[model samples]
Target: MDALPDTLPDAPGERLRIASYNIRKCLGTDRRRNPERTMRVIKRTAAEIAVLQEADRRLGDRPAALTPEVIAQASDYTPLPIAKNHVSLGWHGNAILVRPWIELEDLHHLDLPSFEPRGAVAADLRRDGQLLRVVGVHLGLRTPDRLRQLGAISDWLATQTRLPTLILGDFNEWSATAPLAPLKPDFNVLAPGPSFHARLRLAPLDRIAHCDLWEPARTGMLDEGEALRASDHLPIWGEFRLPG
Candidate 1:
């Protein structure tokens, strides 16, 4: 692939690299240890915006900061999690982290069943002086559960005003028949196939999809091997540039 332009739009109408990953609660291949390893993997991905899945809250608390890198490794983001009781386990859901150059306005999370407080994170990012809506979602695992989750997200997104949007994350779908169908009219699933079960290298569970003013310069899984040998899922990254 060829190199994309260095500068991406920032004000309301610009382009950027946006990704999503299911850290599996930082569960390593060995099935032991979590936090530190998760941090390592995230630092390596180095995306401008990242939507993380399986970010469970301990004692029902989100991570520490709001920075993209901060939220990728820790549970720090805005809106300060009002409550946590949607799933059977409680306090596990999605988080969106954006780079400093980019700003997200109006952020919130949706509640889903089957998964532990499953929800979607939506934000209005400033690009090219234009506002773009980027949504991050971690849907339920079970087919039935996820079906409901998909409906909720599709319905919710329909209410938004027309704007570029990117919906990303560990969608939990292992086949080409992804639940992203309803979202097709607005945004497309930027990646090609399966991306989960990180250790086995099967399934494209983690993803980066977007719409308006952007082109996929390139995209794939991150392989750190050791620096951050944590999480059952591997990180999917993409390089995007502004559309002519």
Candidate 2:
């Protein structure tokens, strides 16, 4: 693949590398637990911020899928401080990991309206003297529930005064354009390409979006051979130019 443009035209700004991945609880196709392999995929992205889905076991106490020592041994990324419940790594299996340079100001979980158990984790982070709010979510599987969950998220975003807000995770939906109507006015929903079913990659289930405060420089899917084996869904990443 050819290299993309290194920089965007006009006013230059801080380049932020953002990524989103669904690790499938670190269980690969081989039917084995491999946190190291999952961490390797995340490290390969070189992302400053990555919102992870399924960072914990689904049953039996729901222990953390990725631990602090494992994260430290694999890369420089640190998981944000989220309210812990039942030894899980994150709230509702949605976790936000950031590079050491990114400092967390505040964190909370949003209870999304859903027929099933669904939620979002929001983090106020400061990077290079710039404040940004990041929301990591996993929407409900049903269409109607997803729409209502998005509406609830929109109501929450309205309360936030932050300019450059990012929402990333496994949306579990195929039609990205229609579902994002609530945020279309302010956020730019990007289709980095199909990221789900790593082997087939027929649908773009995992995605990332940002408010107009930042401009997208480059966006694409991280579908390496190793990434495909790590989980059922491939990771998607985007490089954004934050206003200076």
Q: List runs of model 1 lying over 4 Å from the truth.
A: 1-15, 58-91, 113-117, 177-179
Put down candidate 1 lDDT per residue, 1-244, tens digits, no spaces. 2332334333322336665667666667787755666655565555666667766644435542222344434532222232244321213456655555566557656666665556677777774465777777776677777667767776887787766667777777776556466566655676534455665667766666677556777776665564235777777777676656
How many clashing pairs does model 2 include?
A: 0
- Model 1 TM-score is 0.74
Q: Against the true structure, candidate 1 has what lDDT?
A: 0.60
| Model 2, C-alpha of 212: deviation from truth (Å) | 0.9
Writing each residue's lDDT as its tens digit, candidate 2 over 1-244 gives: 3233433222223688888999999988678789999998887776788899999888877888987679988777788877477477787888888887889988878999989888999898888888888899898899888878878888898987765788888988887555477666777788788887888878888877788888888888777757889998888888888666
Best by TM-score: 2
Number of the top candidate by lDDT?
2
Instruction: Please give the range of 10 consecutive residues that has the lowest summed lDDT in model 2.
Output: 4-13
Runs of candidate 2 exceeding 4 Å displacement? 1-13, 176-179
Cα RMSD for predicted model 2:
3.8
